[model samples]
Target: LWGEACATLETSVGPNNFNHWIKPLRLTGLESGIAHFVSPTRFISDWVNRHFAKDIIGVLSRPGQPVERLRFDVVPQAAPGRARSAASGSAASVRPVASAAAPATTRALRADLGAPLDPRYTFGNFVVGKPNELAHAAARRVAEGGPVGFNPLFLYGGVGLGKTHLMHAIAHDYQMRHPAAQVLYLSAEQFMYRFVQALRESTIMDFKGMFRNVNMLMVDDVQFIAGKDSTQEEFFHTFNALVDQGKQIVISADRAPAEIKGLEERIKSRLSCGLIVDLHPTTYELRLGILQSKTEGFRAQQPDLQIGTGVLEFLAHRITTNVRVLEGALQRLFAHASLLRREITLEVAQECLADILRTNDRKISIDDIQRKVAEHYNIRLADMVGPKRARNIARPRQIAMYLSKQLTSRSLPEIGRRFGGRDHTTIMHGIRKIEELLSEDKAIAEDVAMLKRLLEA
Candidate 1:
């Protein structure tokens, strides 16, 4: 009866969902209008109950087996290499992959709930430059699988800056060195999800056991849990427990701990206690190196594709936002050439990636305009956004407002906010005054033009 219902669910919920959330469950029996089942973990059980319980019950509550409600229970896992006896009848049971057994628990958590680690994100493929050298070195030291001085190693940076790559590399290296050591890697979002599930199911103890039992825990994009109060509290305790037990913790976020708004100060202080490393934005040389490395790898797959000289360099120069965008642009070029049978030249790249190129073009920010305008007139930078009405300060402030309006994509209100919370009407007045000066006074026009050139440069 359970088998039939699951077959119907496989189609209803989709294959990936069925396998991850449904296949692990075993419906033992239906009695007294209640369906009883055994789940590998409370996390999966709670998820299945919340998301797919209605579907399962709907299918089971057919003509014969009437299931009024669904219940998911986590039974004790059998010892390794021991199959359950037929005598243990009626109730179906399965051992959790991350059982509370000695030594193998970390590998089990890694198998069951940890985010899938990318095989390509190892240190071997990580391109090193001055920007990321310190981060790479620190990760390498931690991955050496020794007792390190830092209890928690925090890596923070903007998107596509290799924070996740380093985190994966550390896990891969650490697991390889100590085969029996328990290592678990997952994102902060997953941590919160499991915590939420554990709370819902009254299985908080199970959740604590799974997390704190690991020898090493790596959580990526921890900034996601910033505003989540309960998750933050659980994470703080988990963090402290691991540190108290002398276990290693690796965390990655998009920004520094102090900079993440809505995060508790105590959590910030704990995260800051570690050796915090920032993976700086990629330099042109680093981007070129990455492109070259990627192209070399691509050559093995498409040996016939001809790439012209200076194409990689051109891409490196143009795609300066991050490494991911740089690699994605290169991949698009490869795909274009592979499909069209054309050589990948600079001209072909420009023609094929016009939209990307346009979007990646030099972006001017309000901060840049304000700073340049302030410098050009030799007034303090603070005065550009300050509450002052003097002529020297007010003139450059208006010029900055005019240039910001001209150069940036920001709305008037946003621009006004950037200039120390001035209103849009005030911004409009300042911009108009600058426009009147630009047309009538040659000096104002020349100053605006010169500032524009400097800002662009």
Candidate 2:
């Protein structure tokens, strides 16, 4: 009866988990409504008891072989080579009179050992727009932990554009659905730091054992691993091992994989091998939507304060850099208003965010951008500003027009006159064309992001 129960337990955990974890636990006894087991070491005993004891207990407490509870202890003289012979003795182990009817539930997430998850970054708080809708959807899919369409969901974009937020949101949602999930989330820098620490301590095997065994792995700002040869090498192997086991991986970066300088070619290849989604720069409406969402949360906190309309619109229009900065500005304004006991209005927005608005001032010119775009697309400078409707010239022209509207303070009419004396509606149409491409066309979006970075720098 015990042998049949052990076989059932083995099938429940799969071969890999059974061999590594179950093969070591020796059933010592079944007495006084307690089923006692011993492992070779405290680490193995604790790990098994934490991760697999519930299933093992369930099998042991079957109708034939019953046990009220499971207990694990370390065997000081137990040897790994002898576990095969000794663990079989567990088959002859005795049974208890009364058994615990309920089995232990799955253990909680191992989030404490890695980076901590911020409860506020869940999907409910994320504001979606055309720019970030794809990213948001992909993240939600990965969180579902079903048939993952993408192996490593790579999310890259400008700073404070919700890469990390989406990553955290995935972790939170996944763990919520899977209580026993071994979900690990941390920065690339922390991974490197631990990799180095493991090397110095000669516990590299243990480090690899823990990391490579997780169900889900998320590394934020993976671009940070660029240029560090040893860290990159170790991370590559770790990433491959997890993916080979069909584990889900989520990564975030400030730029797309190919654009990150100093990163290894093979790593880039592997990173891009999976689904790559970019959280395009926030649209004005998206920014306003985010402000409104955040303001509602703040209003709930400070019920007495009545916020005016133009304040959020003003901040959303002015602070165009990143979502982090935008949220921070609103939070700061709310704090100031609460402290002063005043209503949130345009004057308050101006006085409170004066410094941030200055920094958000336009940094690029339409002409400079046209020149840069011309050089990038291998066309003459005059082609950008001249009357040329050819695909080769027009595509780059529209890209430049899009960048102009995004990065410069030029009006549509002003931008049109610069583009071969075209009308404002032509410029608007061109801008709209690029906006359409930004979602459907990857090559064009990549080019625009690269050019924008270069011009900003």
In the range 358-446, model 2's lDDT, one tens digit per residue, is 67765567888999999998999999888878999999999999988877667899898888789999999999999999999999888
- Which lDDT values do the candidates have, in the order given? 0.79, 0.78
What TM-score does candidate 2 get on C-alpha atoms?
A: 0.61
Question: In model 2, which regions exceed 4 Å deviation?
Answer: 1-112, 362-457
Candidates in order, TM-scores: namely: 0.61, 0.61
lDDT of candidate model 2 versus the reference: 0.78
Weakest 10 consecutive residues, lDDT, candidate 2? 100-109
User: Which candidate comes out best when scored by lDDT?
Assistant: 1
Tens digits of per-residue lDDT for model 1, 1-457: 5656667888999988887667766666677778876654444555677788888888878577577898755532343223233223222443332333434433333345566566578899999998899999999999996766466899998899899989988877776565445567889999988788778978777678878877789999999999999999999999999999989999999999999998999999999997999987776688899999999899999999899999998887667676787888999999999999999988998888888776765467788898888888999999989999999899899999988877665779998999999999999999999999889999989888778656643
